[model samples]
Target: MNTTRGADGKRTGRDETAEERADRMWVELIQEVRVAQTGVQILFGFLLTVVFTPAFARLAHTDRVIYIVTVVLGAAATGALIGPVSLHRLVSGRRVKPQAVSLASRLTFVGLVLLLATMTSSLLLVLRVATQADYVLLLVAVVVLWYLLCWFGWPLWVRHRHTSEQ
Candidate 1:
């Protein structure tokens, strides 16, 4: 088997055809989605039950609005995250794995963003109800910043740093 080295100093262990590359990427993407899907599904499920809870009726109007937004975001995240599976299933034998993978990746990215929003809103509502502290917004902002740093910033930095090394 012949192998080529990319400009990034990374050696291609095995030469892969486009289809093979798609197959490998599809598997890797699915593994990543699995982790995210489980979390979002659990959160969405819990959000669905919140409205039926006794405590929900006691929430202020603002809090109830926030809850609705959070639930909607959660539902969207769940749909986006689970989209890849359906996409793959529908296109399984159509010889379009490469395109399917690309679309799925986009959906996964959207799902992650929605998940971030869902978490932020949920936290905001919870904090507002749990305490009258004026620092709740500050606290939520800090957490949002932290999530952005961890979920988006760090990965982007790493990508830039490594790409520049090529």
Candidate 2:
């Protein structure tokens, strides 16, 4: 559906109806959701298994804090990532998909942010455990920088540089 800047929240572009834009947005939303869902599931699985290890019991207080924080972040990410599927199933055929897609996109963004925190903290905990070397913090810092660049920085840069031309 095409949308206009009127009081009604009709679809935004051309003369496409809300249903049409909803359909298109639904497809795009599902594709993005799939990728996020997979990562969150895998990370959640790994986080759950970490508790079974004896080393987990021996973790220092600070490491334990990291573990707990990582688990919470993973849980939040999982919830946000899976929210769209449930949203879709419940609202199917209700003609609310464009709205749902927008909401889902917001949830996915939040999930990604949580995922970033989860991965960073997880790496911090792991590297600290794996290396007693003086460079452990430095190593984690490098990895964090890599993640920030690849995941967030590059995307924003590309969006800023190209989106304007569009």
Candidate 3:
């Protein structure tokens, strides 16, 4: 039944030292990154094959441009998502795990944002090609909003609410 305050004089609500917390965070972050990385990698792989398809040649110039942007975003997402692994490898045994974890978390956030853009653009391109409807933009907009809410908005809200309560 003992508790301690963090350096900031705030209850951390956990019984672990900073190093222990960082280690746990690193493991959790890697697991999250793995899931996102798998999704982005698969999407990127499919995107890479799109250009070789006969249908690609028939795409309008605008669609081609969107495809290029999507591909670039996917590549960036892949890099950001994979960054933590290399980061950990290079910084291993440096006694800077807390700093490393902070950097890795930032990279993972960047990756998720990039993945959102990649997914939005990919959806737009596919719907445009398949449906050829003016409503495609509307549908994509709605989906993007959903992604924003699910990925960022809800998490931020929860953090803010709970932190304030504490």
Candidate 4:
């Protein structure tokens, strides 16, 4: 089989036009977004309830600020994760699907970043409220590094190692 490399260094495996590629990518992007959307929605919902809990009143000022930041990050994550759906709905049949998919993919990436921030902040707040241990900061930093490795490092390594320059 003959294959050509695109400008992005991706080898062409299927004989798809731009529109067909966009359609296929849009479907895949939505499926991926669904997984992230569900997680962020659930997390954001729980974050919303934190303020109403009796324990919330006893939180230190810094912890309260952390909680607020976590909530905001969760909200932003939710918006970004769900942005693709609305983008598709509004742009469907307008012959701009290629652009829409590109934008949606970007939004999904942004959403994931926001989700990471949300989770990190949430963990920090929970740890602060649950313990006075001096190692919480170190623990959180280690966990953040783990998250970064799992969420980004592995995928990037695989991409770089396997992508053939045709």
TM-score of each: 0.91, 0.84, 0.93, 0.94
Please report the candidate that would top lDDT against the real structure.
3
Give candidate 4 misplaced runs (Cα > 4 Å): 1-5, 8-11
Q: RMSD, each candidate, Å?
A: 2.8, 3.2, 1.9, 2.1
Which lDDT tens digits does candidate 2 get at residues 1-166? Answer: 3443223543344566656766877898889889878988898899999999989998999888989999999999999989888988998888777788888889888888888888888888888888857887888889889988988899999978875321
| Model 3: how far residue 165 lies from native, Å | 5.1
Question: Candidate 3 local accuracy as lDDT?
Answer: 0.94
Question: Residues 69-106, candidate 4, lDDT per residue (tens digit)?
Answer: 99999999999999999999999999999899999999
Model 1, 1-166: lDDT tens per residue? 4354554656656587667778999999999999999999999998999999999989999999999999999999999999999999999999999899999999999999999999999999989999968999999999999999999999999988876432
Ranking 1 against 4 by lDDT, winner: 1
Return the lDDT, model 1, position 108. 100
Instruction: Locate the minimum summed-lDDT window of 10 residues in model 4.
Output: 1-10
TM-score of 2: 0.84
What tens-digit string does per-residue lDDT give for candidate 3 at 39-142? 99999999999999999999999999999999999999999999999999999999999899999999999999999999999999999999999899999999
Error of 4 at 74 (Å): 0.6
Candidate 4 accuracy as TM-score = 0.94
User: Model 3, 99: alpha-carbon shift in Å?
Assistant: 0.2
Question: Which scores greater on TM-score, model 2 or model 3?
Answer: 3
If ranked by lDDT, best first, what sequence of candidates would result? 3, 1, 4, 2
Distance (Å) between predicted and true CA of 89, model 1? 0.5
